[model samples]
Target: MPPSAGVDRAPRAAWQAALRGAVLAVACLASTLAAAEGQPGTSIATSVASRPAPAQAAAQPAAIAQRIMVLERQGRARPQETAAEVDAEITRVAPFSAAHRELLTVQGLMLAEAADGAAAERSALALDDWHLHPGAQEAGLAAGAALLIRATFAAHGGHDLKRADALVQEALGRLPPEVSDLDRYRFVMVHGYIKDRAGQLEEAVRLHHQALALADQLGTPWRRAEARTALAYSYFGARQLERARQLSDEALALASEATDWVGLGRAHNTAGIVLDGLGDQDGQRFHFEQAIACAVRAGSKRDEARYLANMADFYLKKGEFRTALLHAQRALPLARELRDPDSELVALANIGFAHISMQHLPLGKRFVAQAIAIDEDRGALAGAASTWLELGGYLEQAGDLRGAVAAYHKHRKLMAGVLRADEQKAILAMQEQYDAEQRNRSLALPQREQQIKAEQLHRRDLQQLLWALAGGVSLLSFGVIVALLRRVRQANRLLSASNQVLRQHGERDPLTGLANRRAFQDEMKRRAADGMLCGTVYLIDVDHFKQINDHHGHAVGDAVLVEVAQRLRATLREDDLIVRWGGEEFLVLVQAMAGDHVDALAGRMLAALEGTPVAVQSRQVAVTASIGFATFPIGPASLPVPWERAVNLVDTAMYLAKAHGRNRAYGVRLRQAANDESLQAITGALEAAAQDGRVALTLLRTEGQAKPVEVAA
Candidate 1:
């Protein structure tokens, strides 16, 4: 029934709390310690300035040190009194002493476990008082240990990859070569981790393999598990789900064998994500449950927060909005407690996304805005980029056009920066590869020198022997060299010609000899990014083209399509751009247009195809086309969107034209004033027509009227 006795009888989290309370009660009361002297935590001073009895100094520290290590093992839920005791012992313990060094490491780890990265950094900084030189036995070990703690804190607690990498590299440089393989494994793991976080997955996999090799060399099961998990994460990012799952299973098995709950939790979480990607709901759920359970058992608040965030994302992906919100809400407090901006960003973004997906626009926007603020403050570029994109979609769907536009702009800006950073990383990788090659070449220089020396010594004899045979072989060698040079030139010429053809093929369709879809999209994307090219897009379909293909065979059908492309191109203005959108379709953009000219142009396009019969295989074939068009800046009051929307609208109109009797145009007019309701109505109509193929199906049975339908202005 006694407090101390109850500690051992309690279970799990309860046992942990009981142990803390019992230890604190004993330390707070001097009489209890006096009654049971030399008990665990009995010798630890309650105040930093308090010194132990000289006779007790030797014995007391040993007991306090052992107790502190026990608390360190128990996780980060220790009471304030327990920390005070450790601090008091820190001051009383001799500087650079074994007890002091051990306490520093434990304190540093404890701060990290609390998700207090800044405090952890400060704890590690206290090691400077030792004044030990780098690579010195105890001093080097202590410094390396501090840096490892600091790196881990930076990585998980703050998501400060740059800081983490620096700390790890510093440790690697300072630690002696004879340092334990376990320490080396930890030191090497940071590079892969940062690369993975930064979206450099291939580089991360390579580094993780290096870490795995070191882990294997050390025969450390836990680190081997961690390295495998890290590699699996990169594979998951690359969407190689089966491989990711296999590696994750291996990692989980190793972690379980080592009783490494943290590793087990991370591996399970990764497995869940991979399973979700594979659409294995039962497998996903199992891993998700296991992950959460392991996170709780591991007692790492940072890991717990991350697991909650991952679950939120999982539910969000599944369209389970309320469940996502619940997990995200639980994560937010822990993220704030940890002061981890990245975690906060994920939690807030998920909450916003769930709300927005559930139609709570205002509430969702507020949460997303808060997340953006944190990301901006922390310089978390990837997080900011993704959140901005989500906000853009949310705002656009909510009909907040201006806000949506602004969010999209921000998203594009961040994406551009991310792309540039990724490109830089790729360039760096290439440079490193080249530098390694150059170094190898430099390494071979000495061997070349030795070879040259041996050759020079034999040169006199060799020159005499060569003089004997030179005259007879000279003509043959010369002829062979000339022949080889000519062959090399011929091959280079052929390769150049081949590459030229390939480049041409990339830009144009071989059959139609028209600009391909990739070329069109590239041009449109460039214009969109530059805030240029706002006009009208015409989507055209040859009426009953499939029937023509079935009746005339594909050869004649291909010829008819080519004729269609030619006729359409002949009618377009020099400034307009046209592309073979797909089979039996053509998309034209009126690059620069005069006021209300697009309507007339559409009419002319329909008339042009009807005016001429295509001559295919020396036979005239009757052909008529239906054209549908949509203009940018949906109405006078609105703004232009990316070319995609314009293309989709036109495509819908084209189908409707095909349905309501071929050879007519249906279009949405520009420069006509319209309210927001009209735009929404048009969008709704397009969506309905698209979803059920109602326009393409029903309108074909319409009354004899062949008039084109007017779209929203």
Candidate 2:
């Protein structure tokens, strides 16, 4: 992926996309604006802007340097306009003094970061070289600023920690030991990013904290907000979601107070990601919109596209296929406009998935294939892994079981690499915790030892008077210590057990205490990996479940679902996997559907609940369910049937049951004929699924006359 493609790549929070370039730009704006209010910043522009100008920039090389620095900061805050402005300024400047050249070099870095390396080669200055400039203290400070910028490009764009480390070294070396608080803060922020990219997340987080403290020392709210945002980004990369969210909230408050739109947009982006993880779909969308609005106000096209992609993800989760496609399609052109391949890949992915949801198989598959190809070509292992997973989903939905299997295999392999990378981050987190505990223990140990010595000294007199009594007391103290150790061990054991239980419950339905759809899918994959080729999947839906909720309230509806799940479990074999698929729906998976097995099983499912009424709120609520089941592979040979298609088949059959009458069961065989496997046939079926309008009319009899009722596809 590109330097800033994390949010666009998907909200696992890689600190890319809206986070990196946008954040850097916003930081520049915030710091400069704060300096306008007499708060200090590392920028030569801020220093000059706070004081006086030195004649014409042409007359004084120092004045030219300051003007260049001011233009550089402005470029970040307004990339659309200032990119060309900075380019012209750099070109117009005749001879390069060390300080003047530093501004030009930093401008190149800002461009590269913003455009994801599109502007890296445009610099006349030696971007690769980091050396001290001969002049006053301000000249050294200029070199430090340039080093930080180059280091940013190296770390984020090139992923070259070695080069970045050298740049940072020069940055630190160039600065005097008594560096300005603002300069030191900027230096620390660059180092923190280097540490983060190197997978030293703990060190990275600490460096960000140091930056925050320096920001505070400057007595600027904007600087404080920038520090909080940087820390939040680090936490996000480390997957410390709660801490990330808290820091983002704090940063947002600061940004809002300052009316810093660029900073606020970045904060909103962070908040949106956290909200997505927490499953607050509405809140996530709201923040995503705010981010886009801020991005537009900040005159940042890249940010606009990034947030649009994120909004597509939000709509995808909501099952609004058309809306998701619209957002993704909108983002694709913007990404292309910037020539950002990584963001383009993600936009393609979003569009493909939306197409799949809309059941446009062939069209969706093409976009997915393109995205995957890009990932493979770019050596984007993480992006490739996620793209393959999306491909697997598309293939499965299209009933191409063989293709889906291949995609899944590729996904699993690439995903292992992704997980391995995270292992280092996990270890760092654990080590940090262990070190903290050791520090606490070390602090207490000295005090404890002193108290023990004092007690022994006091007991010397008692020991002389009564040796046996002293021995008895010593034994009692030892006994108490042993008991305390045992209790501590027991408490640790209980905590471990509790964590284990929490993990297990994470996949189960909270209301029904049954396996959820997620758990069911996992079990299906496990069974497939074990070479279990044949099974039956039953899709059961409660008839008029909404009416039940509307009449009896959601509390009663939930209670009824729990009862229904229990009844379904009672009817199924112990080996069968019963999943609370969704509201008022359950899925049952069992091995084999030979002979009359499917009919018998479906009958048992319907009878399970129809046999008795559910007791809810002291009222006997009538319960009836529609059942649909499908056989895997269609039983001609041993060819595997796609699980997604099997689910869809059963869903349609369930719809048929509803069309006929409530409280009935239906079954379907997987389409096994050669013609059914063709693209044309699949397209037709998918088209029908997409145009799910009620074409057939069902007769509803009331007393004597029969009223026509619509039946959906």
Candidate 3:
């Protein structure tokens, strides 16, 4: 993207539109009022009102236009106007002139109250179609204004880092090099802010450093503190909590000196997050409150909403469901009011988590489901993964084991893709930096060679040349150190690969390279933490495995287990983490599917393992396996030993399958007590129901009749 197309472009457009409207109104009024009072058309109100009664209304536009023209003059007289007055006047003239519309809208936004950013944003967007030619002052000003307004809007917009970045870049490009030094640093700081949002942490750090350097040169404390706050944001995102808090403290002290409410609010919020991470709940809460107060005093709704969401999350983490719910509810309307989708997502998710923790399953599901739906629509893969984990856990808690498993599987798949995408971006960024450095080095090669030749000629004497050789040897030794550093980096890359493999093993079965019970526990823990979507878990057991080992040789039994592992791995998605629980038992964690799919899963495993013979004592022996599966959130009653109970339930179902006929699959069911016989009967019934889709989705009755809702494509 070009510099002109960077972050903050949208807000600039709004300000431009508002400004044009103001200019038009001022010009028309000035001319008409001047005529009415028989005075030169200098002031807006007098020139417009002074026109003939029949022509007065018609002269309004003309007078406003004339005022704008005069204002553009080099020596025109004018009274000062507050930022608020300037904003109101700009809004008045927002409707006229397509060419300068965007620029005027942006100019108007520069003076708008931060609280009214949403409305101002709408005005800016209205000028999206306005374009300017190259080197046009009007165009450049509009772009710059749009960028500034956008950056301000984004500070509180939650998850819109992409849009924020584009606007900032656009604004920076439009800025003329001849502009005041302070203004230049302002643009640089905004750019740093955008980089922070974009998850380009190191880049944001570099940009902030640049901004701070400029501020130091200009001796501007105001801009310098702003840069410090921006740096803190970047550090926080990078998980450098200590550094972020330190920078935030520095920013806070400076903000107090300057009496800058916006800066102070940001500093407080940053400090609050770091404190929260450090387990200083009281300190975090206090800072959050302070942030909210400062934001409210500054009339900054965006900041207020942000702190509200932060407070809600803190409460949720503290197990204060009611308080968390209250804060989340408080933030929701404000988020909507600001038209910020990101804040909306966080508030809604927080509220949903509170409800879930409170045991309000249905209500909690609704809220979390809504968040997932919104995130999915926006193509936010990471958000969707988090929501899936939460929902899956809820379903498992509700006795829908199959549904939970499916949900977990979906979450894993999406999260893997997200991680890969981030890795790719990092790699690309590294390549770009390397390429740039190489080009710079290549460009300077000739000059460097010339300098070396001149030095060589100056040292013509043997003794002088000998001294020069000694200096050259020293430089060569330094070069060797640099080369060693490069080799160390290369070794680190190899170490990283080994570490990745080791990490993967921790989540997989040692014997079969399948997933382990610990992995399942870890996933369940994550789901519980996220507190979203309901899910189901499946505990499956191979029938009469001990008998098989007793009857057959241990080697043959081992072969059977290995074969089963291969089939399970081949049948499931890469996202589905499969693990051997123990002995003949295995667990499959899936997401987004229902209990009905469990039968299909069983059938696939059976078919994949079928007709494979094991050699025992030089003879071929075929072994048949019976599968017992149990689902949660779909059973008659909730099982407290959710994960473990799922396994036992499935074990009973497998026994039932063995009794009915060997090598068949059966589903597990809920029981009043640990009655193995009763569990088997229920499992058989559930398995039968699975065939008719009764376990997957049943038609619901609305008022006395079955109701149907068609899904929109």
RMSD of each: 15.3, 13.0, 19.5
Tens-digit lDDT track of model 3 for 1-713: 00000011111111111111111134554566467434565444322233345444555455444444333210001112323333344544434342245324433343232334655565565444345444443445555766666665554333456566667777778765666554566566656655654555667777787777886786534445566766766665555668878887887887677565655776677777556544466887898889778767755555566677777766765667899899889988987986655556677877877787787867976887777777788677776886776566545555556655555555655654665535644654554454334333343244644554453444344344445555677665666555545554554555455446445644555457776655665676686654222344444556555345434433456666777787778888888767787667777767636545755665566555554665655656565666655555434554334443345445544543444444555554343443434433443344443444334222111223223211110
By the lDDT metric, which is better: model 1 or model 3?
1
Global lDDT of each candidate: 0.61, 0.62, 0.54
The TM-scores, one per candidate, come to: 0.52, 0.52, 0.46
lDDT score, candidate 3: 0.54
Worst window of 10 by summed lDDT in candidate 3:
1-10
Q: Write the per-residue lDDT of candidate 1 for residues 603-702, one digit (tens) a residue.
A: 7777778777888767677888777776676555555554554565566566446544567777654344545444434443653433443222112111
**What is the alpha-carbon RMSD of candidate 3 to the true structure?**
19.5
* Candidate 1 Cα errors over 4 Å, as ranges: 1-115, 129-167, 397-403, 410-713
Q: Rank the models by TM-score, top first.
A: 1, 2, 3
Q: What is candidate 1's TM-score against the reference?
A: 0.52
The per-candidate count of clashes, in order, stands at 0, 2, 97
Q: After superposition, how far is residue 440 of candidate 3 from its true place, in Å?
A: 12
* Candidate 2 clash pair list: 4-17, 5-17
